[model samples]
Target: MTPTIALLLIITFLLSTVGLLVLIWSISTNQFSNSQNAARTIFTPGEEGHSEDPAREDTSAYKGDSKAAKEAFTARRVQDQSSKPAVLIWLSSAVFWLLIGSFYGLLASIKMHYPEFMADSQWWTFGRIRPMHLNAVVYGWSSMAGIGAVLFLVPRLFKTPLRGTPYAVTGAIIWNIGVILGLGAINFGLSDGQEWLEFPWQVDFLFVLGGALCAVPLLLTCARRTVEHLYVSSWYFLAALVWFPFLFFIANVPKVFPGATGATVNWWFAHNVLGLWVTPLGIGIAYYIIPKILGRPIISYKLSLIGFWSLALFYSQVGIHHLIGGPIPTWLVTLSIVHSVMMSIPVITVAINHHGTMWGSFGRIKESPTLRFVWIGALMYTATSLQGSLMALRSVNVITHFTHYTIAHAHLGMYAFLSFILFGAIYFIMPRLTDREWPWRRMISLHFWLVAIGILIYFVSLTTAGWLQGLALLDAKTPFLEIVQMTIPYLQARSLGGGLMVAGHIVFVVHFIFMLSRRGAMTQGPTLFRVRTKEISQ
Candidate 1:
């Protein structure tokens, strides 16, 4: 490695190490002593009076409030006035993007096996459509849905009205504009040539502005919060809110760092988009939804503290592992791998807290659509993160990196883990926001099974094909072209899986549209799968 690259890698490693040490120090102290209270904050109601500073919620402002106040709040069950309008606007847009992204994903999958399928149009070229599928799904579908969830959950957690609703609404609108503009630019051959950061430089500013706009309302709502203790979910959401804009702008700024440095930033930014931003929101949603629905507190607040801090300290550094064996210094890649392994600590801790809370709720999983999907996602998060840690090892990376094995792992995290959480969030939040029931229980089940089966097929095929391809490539006698040919069948399987997933998304959108229309009435408590007689009798 060159001296300059080595110097940069050393500096980055030292910075990450210092951050980890600081987090460990804070955890060692009693900074998070009130873990139980943190969990209780959401269930606890606010005083009738609001506070100008959110810090007061933990202090004298509501010191005199009684159990009677909580009873009153529960009886009243204040409507989610802060979140409704903005949520509807943002979530509706998210569903729209999900459809677009899934469709593009299917197209991209088809082009993999059938390069001749749409060869004539530059817009439909696999190169362009592939990134469109990625950006549209990540930035357009997942991020927007996450923002909507945060908008909903933050105010509800704080027992405060959503502040700056107009601004949030405007931000959501502008954010959609950015997604549209960015994707449109890419389709028209204006990509920035970065993986997951393909949107042109000019388009990045719109997202930055849109994100800043969405963030202000969340922060202001926090400032106006009435909860005495910050919930673990709140910490994740707020930290993500702060971290994303910082990464978004830094990674998108042009000419600031050129050539190899820029490539490093590109990979860093791309991976952190998953690790830092969207992953936290998904976990935070789980943190809120699991406990609220099951009426059980998380197993240990200290564990939650550990999980959050470890994730914050470790995840940012782990992103660079994507650059393993690349031009970057070996030290940087080594740091990333070490951090990736350290990540398993947080993953295991979170698994314990989430699953331990649901130990006896197996029946509820079948009964509640939200619980089933979210619970499955929580499990998948454990699976995916652990797999990621394993993949970071040099041995595993040799076979997986740049192969379909990597693709399978990516989907396992994004579609299976993150999308499942968002799916559950939409199902849970929609009825609350629209105050209308989903039209059909069977449809929800159908939607679940289709996507579930589809992804299983997709993941299994790609992983097997990727491992074979990697092994083949490693052999000098094996022809690269023959290895590519061998993957054709798996590519076909992938396309088939993509088709099924697309069909599932279609069912979801149709259902969501019905919910929005006059046809969807608040007719049932929740459109769950049919309960067994034994379960019902109990």
Candidate 2:
């Protein structure tokens, strides 16, 4: 076994030992006797019987706290207004980088089929631009937008204004600068040479510093929250805030591990960035948006908690499954496989909560742009997660590991799931932030169709192509050149799909700019999709 595996074994053993001791200590002290009190601590006085969503059914009669609830609701809106400046900065940065990233992604996709498209410029080579696209979207768009949503949610959830707006704004600026510098470095061939950690180590500190600065206000706000019981969404936000920086720091420590150990660390960091960092942000936002728009609570609070804790337990280990066939120890890979399968717990639990919450309210999607985007995103989360868990198995990994199938899966998670949720959130938050309706509902609908159709085409074409490619690889009679030729049509299809998504992004940016400039429709009602009188269900 390699040194890394040995060290991991030792660490696991020690941790298990410590956990066992803690369990014994707790049992001896009769800690389980008051487990109900601990469980009940998650609920505030007069809130346990009420729906968690602020827009929930009339629960004022149940708790006899109608006046208090009204006051709290008003305070949340005021807090949202106060959070506008800083939140907008983060969101604006997110949108800007999103546009930039989409173009880079399109260019990269085009190069896949037509390699000569950008051959004239070394700066635009696939190697450089691909990493540029990844970083721009991952750190630039997704992180910034997720942070913006968190900034917006925290104040309302905690019933307080964000504590340090100036610092958060500074952090957004610094974060953008880091992305710019990192992408520039990639363009010049100065990458650190890994899939996710492509940014040179020199600029890594900017992200660390910027993320820390952004985190301070949220942490302080949480600490000083007016609400006694922490909501499930808050739990996700707080955990993501802590997980991301720590993961980034450890992963980019600059030549700490070498050879097999380095590869192990690389996959561990890469996968966790998705499962731990971004997944929480996406799930947290969905948990809020789904119920908030539906005017109801999740189907089961206990199930939500189960999902959260199970995710924390299973996701951290599941990352190692990416290195299943590598030089790692067999036992370690098996452990990860076990965790991967166990991930079904959280995935099903969350699916039940999110989809069940939106059960009877599916018709609302016609009138609510936010619900349309978010609901589809939530569905994709279930699809991509189950796909991921299945792929972690050795049998499935052998076929799909190095194929474009993985790429399809990644986009399914990142774009269809995470980006879609972010889009919905922006749609919901922007009008409230600007105090203006979107100028055109048609534009929003067009944007959604373009991207939605694009991803559908993108996912289907690549999944089929990758499966065929995998089969050919397994066949000894198949020529490598023949496999390459077979995938060309799919690659071209990917570019076409990417082009549509890019167009959608452009439309979104234009709409966002209009809203920010206060040029939106001068109407009091929200800019919802037009529905025929007969189609209106509620």
Candidate 3:
């Protein structure tokens, strides 16, 4: 047997030995004993089986007059209101970038099928525009929005007033300036030629600085927390804050890894960008929003612990799976595969906690727009994560590698999962920050359907076309031109889907501006798809 295969065997044996040791320790220490008692630790006095939302009947009526509870609620509201300027700055910038990114993305999608559409313009060429779309959405839209939500959430969770609002606002401005310069550089042919790391290294520094400034308040607020119990959401947020800057700095440094090693490092950073950075933000938002709206705790905090640690452990190594069949060591690839399979542990644990929380509360989806968007996003998280694990398998990777199928899967996580969760967060948080309801309820519904249907179409068409393309590439008799020809129709369909998504984004931006300007009928309750008789009459 080859040395690589022998190494793989050795590693597998070591992992099995570790597992055996852990099992033995569990038994010897009676860790599994009193399972019910351990499970009860997730709850506080009188809060079991209860909704966390103060507005919920179970909570509001009984606890409304309790002096300490009322005081805490008032303090929390003050923190939420104080963080508004910073959150608005970040989120508005995010939405603006969303529109710009959508334009770049739709243009790139169209150019795939119609090469002549913008052939004369070097700046609008597929080479530049595609990366621009990627950086714009990933950094400008998703990262900013996640930061905004974190700013809003950390203080509320800690029961402390936000300490560094001015710094956070400055950070938002600095971050936006960095994104602007980076995109301009990309358009002017100053790209680093790396996929996700296209922006020049100087530009990368600004992001690091801006992100550090943004992170200070969160860490300080967390440190000065009044509450004793740190929610699982806070853990995810804190871990992400720690993970992203390290990944960003290591990946962008010059001349560290050369050639094949550089390629491996690039993929490692790219994959972890989603897994550690964006995924945690999305999951953290879901952890808060789902239960906050439903007014209940997550089904199992024990499961949440398993999910978080398992994700951190397994996801870190799984990035190597993207480099399968490359010049990398075979043992590394095998290890990634093992970790990828183990990822199912966290994915399932999260799925159970999130979906289990929603079990009997499905009907509330219709009444509340925030829950509807977040629920669908949370469900997609499970779907995309499982699909990702399967794709990491060598068998599946052989078929889907270097194909548009990968694009479909990325969107299933990025747009369908993370973006949807952020969208829900924007909807929920905006009203509270502005102390105003959404101006147009119909616009919110329109925005949801357009993007939902658009992503469905985008994912389905590209996935089918990619599978066929992959199969054709494997056949010795298949001509290269035939493979290219097969993807054209799907590319056209992708453009159409992209168009719909862009329209949805436009509606969202307009609605957001209206809310910011206080332009609609003022109402007393949360905005719902269908207004109740009591609300309508009032």
Candidate 4:
């Protein structure tokens, strides 16, 4: 085996050993029990039975007029009237970008089927349109939607009204405009030609401006929070808020660094944006949804802290793994590979914390749309990180670099993990926002299955096809054209998967619109899978 491949195997073994040890520890500590009590906690209303301590009692001292504690609790439960306008602005921007991104995906899929579909238009060329598709999906749809959710969720999680609501609205507008102009400029043959940072230097200023605007609401919400205990979700959101703008500004500075160092910095920023920005949002949603649905405190607050800090430390340095075998220095690649392998420390900690928390609640997975989506997303987080670490190994990179395998990895992380978690978040948030339950439970069930199966088809086909192509390229006898031809069948399979996923997205959009219009059925409890009448009787 090549040194890179051998190193990857060693890392895999180490992660597996660590996971086994964790499982053993959990069992010994009685943390491995089923979490059935937790799942019923959400529906248990009032502070009587659910109070953390039984000794606390209602007294005249606590009920005194104009008391600070009472005022704080009231403030926590009340929604801010001013925040609605800002949330709507953010939501509208997110939805518009979602549609544009879907269309770009559709166009890109068509080009795969017919390479010369838009031969006459320079702006429609494959290279230009490909990056546009990526930017549209990542920056336009995902980032916008994530921010909208954050605008809504951060305040709710913190139990406080958003501060500077108007600035938040302004930021959403600016962000939307920036994305549009950046995409337009790139499609119109103006670009820096960097992989993920394709937009020109001038356009980046708008992003910085918009990012500054967003920081205002987040900072204010944090300051105004009534909840004494900061939940794991809040931690992730706060970290992401601090991380994104700093990385964005540093990465977009033009010609500030020398040749290969620039490339190294760019990739570092690119990969971390995924880890710091998108990954945190997804993980935060999971942390909230799993516990909220199960109605339990997180399995172990200490474990979560370990996972969070480990991820922050390890992920920041692993981006150099992407540059392995490139013109970059050898030590940089080795350091990255080491960091990538060490990432398992965080990945396993998070997996244990999330999965272990659900130990006895597996039955609910069948009934709760939010739980099902979030669970799958949580699992995929582990899978994708493992795959990423393996790919970082020099030997694996030699085979997988520039192939569809990398494409498969990206989709697994972005679509399967992050998007799935977001879908769950939407399901959870919509009811709270609209004061009505979902109109169609069956549609949600269908949405879950379609996307799940679509991801399976997408990942399997492309990964197998990519591996074969890579091996063929390595073999001197196989011609390059034959390798290209082999990928067509896999690409066709990918389009099929994309079709299913898009169909599910359409279902979700319609469902969201129905809920927004208040056309859905009214219900007292959450729109859960199982009807648990009197299960948690007050």
Candidate 5:
């Protein structure tokens, strides 16, 4: 490696080490203690006597003298602690966006086969529709749904009510509006032309505003939590809450950096939006789902901490690896590659923790829809990260770069891993929110099979086809157009996979709508797969 690459690697290593040390110190100092207490504690009036220190008397001496005063304080606290309304609004926003985004994706997929499908319509053109599909999925579906999930999960994990429900609601509204305006602008030819950050400067302000609004509730909820043992999921959620706004704001700043610097920052922000924002939300959900299904605590809290810190440390520098073989400095690419390989530490740590937690519970997966989705998602996470590390290598990138292989890798991470986890989280959370079981266990089972099989077909065909295409391009004897022609069959298969996947999504959406309308059968317990009488008795 060149000196610059060596220096970059050293810098990344030092930063990660320092961050890990700080995390260790914080854990040792009990800083994360009482994280879950905020859920119910805010409902109680003034602080009570500490069980550990009886001499520490209640401080509200004046209020203690009046029974009415104490009751009023308690009532106010309950009002402050409620989060149901905020969660509802956020979820509604997510569902609306998800439908719209999914349709855009369908349109884009079809346009790939029939480029002239909407030839006369400017708004429906491929360029406009492609970005719309991305923005819709990233901002509309994933981010909104993630926020909703976190809003629900954090309170339960922290054992506290969300502190600023109104603020969260406001943020959701602003975020949805921003998404609409941004998509509309891009369709109408008002784009800044950045890949992920395509929205105009004015629209970026709304994102910042929304982000700031959301952060308040998260911080306040963390501050007021009552649970003493901060779960691994909570840690990931809290860190992501802190990381996202910082990266978003820094990346969008105009004219503050040179052209190359801006490109580096933009890609960094683009990549981390997945790593820091979506990845944490997905991982957090997995952390909750795996253990909840098994009715056990995590396998090892120490491994979780190691995974969390290592991810934050190593994943931050991976964007530069994307710029490898480009005009960017060789040092930057080399540094990114090293950090990319180092990512194995976190991936392995998380895999060990998750697998160890579920070591004896594989049988449970058959009966539990949530477990099936989550376990598959967890496994995909390992596969994608390892694939990513290999792809970051210069030798490997030479073949994979600008090919369908990258697309396959992206879907492996985004759809199979992250989207599956989100689906599992929704399955786990919706019953609690609605106070009703799912409409049909059979529908859920069908949904899982369709999506699982569809993704497998999609990945296998495209990956194999992409590898051949890449090899053909590299070979001097192979004709370029013939290589393109060779991919037509795989692309057709991909469309079939997309069709099945879309059908699965439609099934889920229909089920969700029916559940929301209270049209499903009323049941007391969670909807589980029917078992033989003997097994049920056991």
Candidate 6:
């Protein structure tokens, strides 16, 4: 809005334009001419982490390769891939954060309905609690879990063992420290005072350092991979690894951009952390786990290629859409909206690949908890992406921008979509990691259904209430008090939903701890949802 801010925005836009031009140039050079080669990594030389029969030795597709190479590959794959102590350590940390964050979320939701419940203590104030809860969930549970999942996946995909387990453990320790320091800073009101960027700038360097340390071995693993073709999941994994730190440092750098343009940077960082960082991580993990469980290659694997590139191309520019009616230029906002709608191209292509992969094999969904959870996430991904594109429209934005509609939309993507994917990833990976099965079928079922029902209630109620709230705001004659009164019922409903979710999280934590301790009656086989025999047989 000011001269300085406008100038900063122009510079930012120009830099982005130059970056896009270079990307187009890379595309023109035929760098992406080999989808076949990339997809072939799924059938890497001697991976035996397959077969429904636990007792069966690998009858890998690459039998023609030399015995020595097979021996070396198998040695690498089994030696430390599933055996590493660090994997469990990181997972345990992730689970701790997931539980704590959900607890924080429950507290925040309570404050929303009953603001005076803890008004006496600034430490427990809503203002401080809300941001802390967000940071905990987004960075703590989601990002850590995502990293843990990919750590398990990369070795399996690359046909290699993880190196530097101690380094990763160190990184996790420092990362947790950074998060704690940041949370403390925020609660003390010594924050950057923006939504996702509230983590104090003083502590930002620790996270960057910690992330870099963790990334070192993962990047080395990418270089050390023996497979001829990098799988599509690897592509997603590599991009997210690179995208997140870069986004974090650039977006959080103090004194880099001034005033209102800083707000642009703030939002751009926050939303892209979702789109470019975690979204790719979830998609990459899904791309691997889905077909692996089905014992088949992804249907129309070429479509996966389209979706990957389109997402990379389209998503980075989309965060600006949140600034549609804000202090920025009209043209930039217009450009962002166009990109948001264009995002549907990637979303639809991904949906086609995902849904089509499971099209006739729908019954497989009934047989594997991994399949059901991941498949539900895939469906939610489609819904959330299309909803996002629609919400980017000016007519839609005018109604939903500042309302609970945005909150509902965010939960749809983050909780319903991403968390579901992460949940399923853990289920699939833990068996391989622990060499055991989920101990209780009922807990698994309860976890799935309770969270599913709670999120549905939370999303639908808030969405409906938000639309009405936004409409009321637009109606100049309507009193603001009436709008506040109207939201009370929906807020109460949200608290109920949040409580159900808390119960589910507790159930899942208990089950996860049982799995870790190797306690209780272990499942003798792959746990799956009950379905008709004919459908499963087909």
lDDT of 1 by residue, 114-211 (tens): 99998998989999999999999999899999999888888887877788898899999899999999999999999988888889989988998899
Better of 3 and 5 by TM-score: 3
Deviating ranges (above 4 Å) for candidate 5: 1-81, 257-259, 523-538
**Better by lDDT, candidate 4 or 2:** 2
Worst lDDT window (10 residues) for model 2?
A: 54-63
Q: Using Cα atoms with residue i matched to residue i, what is each candidate's TM-score against the true structure?
A: 0.89, 0.89, 0.90, 0.84, 0.85, 0.88
TM-score of 2: 0.89
Worst 10 residues of 1 by lDDT: 51-60
On TM-score, who's better, 4 or 6?
Answer: 6
Q: Which residue runs of candidate 1 sit more than 4 Å off their true CA positions?
A: 1-30, 44-79, 523-538
Q: How many angstroms is residue 416 displaced in model 3 relative to the true structure, after the best TM-score fit?
A: 0.6
* Overall lDDT per candidate, in order of appearance: 0.83, 0.83, 0.84, 0.75, 0.76, 0.79
What's the residue-level lDDT of 228 in candidate 1?
74
**1-538 per-residue lDDT for model 3 (tens digits):** 4876888689879988997898799789875565444333333333334333321111122222346544554565677877888899999999999999999999999999999997997988999999999999999999999999999988877878888888899899999999999999999999988888999999999999999999988988888887656677888999999999999999999988899888888988999999999999999999888876665677787788779889998998888888889998887788888898999999999999899989998997776678888889999999999999999998999989989999999999999999999999998788767756677778889999999999999999999998898888889699999999999999999998999999999999999999889885554342211212222211
Cα-based RMSD of the predictions, in order?
6.6, 4.9, 4.2, 8.1, 8.6, 5.0
lDDT of 6 by residue, 225-292 (tens): 77766788888988998999999999988888887798788778887998899999888888887766
Best first by TM-score, ranked: 3, 1, 2, 6, 5, 4
Off by over 4 Å in 3: 1-63, 523-538
* Residue-pair clash count for candidate 4: 4
* Tens digits of per-residue lDDT for model 4, 260-293: 9998998899899898899988887788677666
